[model samples]
Target: MNRRTLIIVTAVVAVGLFAIGGLLYSPTSKEVAVTKPVSNEAPLVRPHSPVFGAKDAPVTIVEFFDPACEACRAFHPVVKKILSEFQGKVRVVLRYTAFHPPSEEAIRILEAARLQGKFEVVLERLLETQPRWAPHGRPADSAWSLLDGTGLDVERARRDAKLPGIVAVLNQDTADVKNVGVTGTPTFFVNGKPLLDFGAQQLLDLVEAEVASN
Candidate 1:
């Protein structure tokens, strides 16, 4: 081969290897999810689960997610996009599956935000600043500071987060998570059907199909 051709070939191979290495080391690659056929819908939604769309929407996406989960953080935008595309026809119900130790604290903060009717705002702030607080195995203590300008009364949220009611919400969701056979974060259920073939496209397709059927 000519010197120029060999150089180009080497560069292309390097790029390909780099891309492959990125995929292998990505946080999503380490996520372990186990989904069983959902025959019962009762455990999917509770009255207190955070809902992020029209309450009467025909299609429901129940997401069991951990706030500190990297995979869940990565999929946040995808979930938002789906909600936007299916506006008024689809709703997202957030189920806190606090798989990470730090996740319970985040979930408590979210539950507190929900009390002040600022769930979505606080949720967006947390996800946007996830890397700062939640860095893999480390504790997400910095997550509290990231919510400063989200209009959530931090003092009040702190107090409310310890309430029995808040604990009840967490406990109930934990039980439902086990009942529904969810073993990981970002597990989605579209119209009571589990997304067995997992992927962003698969989730979108499932939502689209449910929306069309309804």
Candidate 2:
């Protein structure tokens, strides 16, 4: 080969190796810091608090979820299991991504439930019964049915769902997802670092590692 060709080949090889090394070593970098801006919107009412974990918890897991997404449905149990295992050790923040119209309604219902101080009960019911109600089309009927079981008056729940303030909270969550560059359902963030694996064990491992280091 000519001297120029050899030089070009060497540079290309070096660049390729650097790219591979960066990918392999990237995870060891320090956690990214996320600064959430203060919003004038009213606080959401819900169980376990909207904050990802105990304010004192060492690790935080932020999850962006879509109510009608099948993958989200599948992820709920995994999240529940993790929470049960790590209870107060890790903080988990759940944000609605609203990728579908039904998700908007679902977010509204959740916000309304928060107003009633029954948000956790309502959220669990929705996640648990998603398979029976969430199908090919809009799940408005199913959503209504689930709310009915919450023992909070159905008319009151509907009214709360339509409130402008509740809708604003949903919008705020949607904005959060966009801000974080989350493009899909059930994306998890450990200490503000996005976990692409989506597997329960992988996610737990990341959280555990973060906690151990602290």
Give the Cα error of residue 99 in candidate 1, in Å. 0.7
Q: In model 2, what lDDT does residue 83 have?
A: 65
Best by lDDT: 1
Candidate 1, 1-214: lDDT as tens digits: 7543443344344334444542111112223344555667678888888888899999999999898876676666667767878899999998988887678899999999989989989988888787778777555456778888899999999999999999999999999988777887678888888887666666778888888999
TM-score versus the correct structure, for each prediction? 0.81, 0.71
Quantify all predictions' global Cα lDDT against the true fold.
0.77, 0.63
lDDT of 2 by residue, 1-214 (tens): 7543443344344334444542111111112233342232122213333663476677777777787766666555556556666778887777777886567877777878777878788888887776656664644356877666676666788898888887777767766666566666667777756675545556778878887887
Weakest lDDT window of 10 consecutive positions for candidate 2: 22-31
